[model samples]
Target: MTSIIQTQELSYEAAIKMCVAVTQHAHQLGVSVGVVVVTPAGVELASVRMNNAPLHALSIARKKAYTAASFKIPSFNWQERLKHKPDTMSALLREENFTYLGGGIPIIVEGKLFGSIGVSGATEAQDIECAEHAITEQLNSL
Candidate 1:
């Protein structure tokens, strides 16, 4: 029997660090965003909404994280597919809690997917940039 080393899921510390980095990045960019960090099963680990952020941004960010963690694909890809394939998109849209938008990113550790992080409230591009920077700057440090 080949014994495999066990890798743990995301820690509260990691989630907090990622959240701080994400929120700071958004502030530096002048974007008031809502961010969500979720486990692989779509459970939220941490969430934050900046002051003056849109009310819908919290739900949007959560959906983005759920979509990425459940589908194992970037949320923007679903958005693109939805634009080109309405029927398929409709089916996917019907899938419980999936979203088609930017700002969702999977967190990979030791070649395994741990969970996802998502940001919303700015332009799609800016949302994505904030999420990416969070992972690159904070998650990597963990």
Candidate 2:
């Protein structure tokens, strides 16, 4: 029935692997960071905070994951998308767990959205790199 929808469930194992991989990458880069993996519904599955990662990073990372999963778009891209739509941007910023940060990305599996990853505490470039590398080397291999 059209009213019933089937959804792919994200595995907790994959989420934990993602958290570890992201943390490893951040360490290799000499950047302490917070990493999180979440389902498309924005429920967190795994989370990590590398040594010395800022206390605030955990909250920011979770929000970044939520934003990407909820919107199915990289969180950083929101900056440009709402650039000309100030009213919308303002409204969005008012919401909790939403950010236009570069560390957030959507995870695609077999041409379908799986979930999302978000990293924080380092430069935006470094955060993005760690997330991408973990997803590519860890999740994509699954």
Candidate 3:
């Protein structure tokens, strides 16, 4: 029999900090957005939606976070990675929690993945910028 193992997961405080950072960045850009952070197991730790952000953004942000944590890759990369693989692309698209758009980013530290952050409710570029800013701010705080 094999024994089960565990690894470091994202802390609630860290997840909230990430969401705040992304929200601040979006505010600075004069954009309303939604942000979500998830653990390595794809469990949501924290989430926020700006006052004017679309209601749909809440679910989208969560999906992005889940996808990033589940795959350990930037959500945007999936689009390019699957561009030439129609079958794979179609299959992935069929997933209820999968998103190939930008704004999802994995949080890796010391070669270990802690979780992921996702932003939505703005242009893809804007969403990506917010996600990146959150990561940079989180790293700096550490």
Full ranking by lDDT: 3, 2, 1
Off by over 4 Å in 1: 1-7
Model 3 regions lying over 4 Å from their true place: none
Compare candidates 1 and 2 on lDDT and give the better one.
2
RMSD per prediction, one decimal?
Answer: 2.5, 1.2, 1.2
* lDDT (tens digit, per residue) of candidate 2 on 11-103: 889889888988888888999999999998898999998879999988999999999998888899999999999999999999998999889
lDDT of 1 by residue, 1-142 (tens): 7699664568877887888888999999998999999998888999999999999998999999999898878899877667878899889878767888899988876778888999999999999999999889865575
Relative to the true structure, candidate 1 reaches a TM of 0.89
Question: TM-score per candidate, in order?
Answer: 0.89, 0.94, 0.96
Residue 134: error of model 2 in Å?
Answer: 1.0
* Model number with the top lDDT: 3
Candidates 2 and 3, the one with greater lDDT: 3
lDDT of 1: 0.87
Clashing pairs in 1: none
